[model samples]
Target: MARMISAPVLSQEKRERYDAFRQERTFNAYSVGNDTVMTRIRHKSLDCSPGCAVEATLQLIDGKWKGVILYHLLQGTLRFNAIRKRLPNITQRMLTTQLRELERDGFVLRTVYPEVPPKVEYSLTTRGQTLEPVIMALKAWGDEHTTFGHVPEICADMKGSPTNS
Candidate 1:
């Protein structure tokens, strides 16, 4: 059964604890600087909070661009510019940073093809694909309740788009 995890917005303490958990995982990730770390420590579970995994989920996906990124990826594999077109307000830097984070967190697979300039595209990894149902549910909730009907276009004009005209 899916673990029913309803965590609050990440508090500073939780973030600190999560960092500690990450450090612990890193330290415990290897055994005394050996090349076969996982071979030795393969069976042990890292020390984590009661709901650390769930907490990590909220932290990774609840940010401004994350949900949107995941949502568009649900539609299909999308190039960086396609994502930018969907979210005209996000700066190129911000989008780049978010994609990097998602890749780091194993939720996004960024494929860079060798081409004229560069051909880069992003899609949801299996782990990320698992999140579609949950994200869609959240989207449905927002669509039904948000005063603006939760349309991206409705919010698009809030700042009149981010690019310099």
Candidate 2:
């Protein structure tokens, strides 16, 4: 007798509305094996009021590197070292920690393979993919005003390598 809670899947119509009203609330289903136990959608976190959707979001992704990590994963699945290559500035400990947090929060899925080398890959869950528009919006804003250079520059800086002007 064990309980497992997989991510919920929204329908096509609801998916269309996901981006627009995602912040205002949340919903999830609980189950034990194949039997669904319960489901709920509500706004209890913000004193049962609105306007804190953005706050809820920030609580999930508010960190120096989580957003960036999510952005890289958006490209597709990546192995641990590969992710390290992308964000060289992040220490191994920090990267492992963030990845664990993302996995715990249902944003990242980590799969382990039993092999001589023990391969592991990280990808986004359905819930994680829902953040695409938000991540992209942040990228667009940074592109327009940050002048902080793109991924290449960031990677170079992380590696302590010189960049061409």
* Candidate number with greatest lDDT: 2
TM-scores for every predicted model: 0.60, 0.63
lDDT of 1 by residue, 10-93 (tens): 468855865553433333232343322111222145345566666656767866899889988988899999999888789999
Candidate 2: segments with Cα more than 4 A from true spot? 1-44, 149-165
> Candidate 1, 118: how far from true, in Å?
0.9
- lDDT of every model, 2 decimals: 0.75, 0.80
- Measured by TM-score, the strongest candidate is 2
Tens digits of per-residue lDDT for model 2, 43-128: 54665556677767887887788999999999999999999988768999999999999999999999999998899999999999
How high is the lDDT of residue 76 in model 1?
A: 85
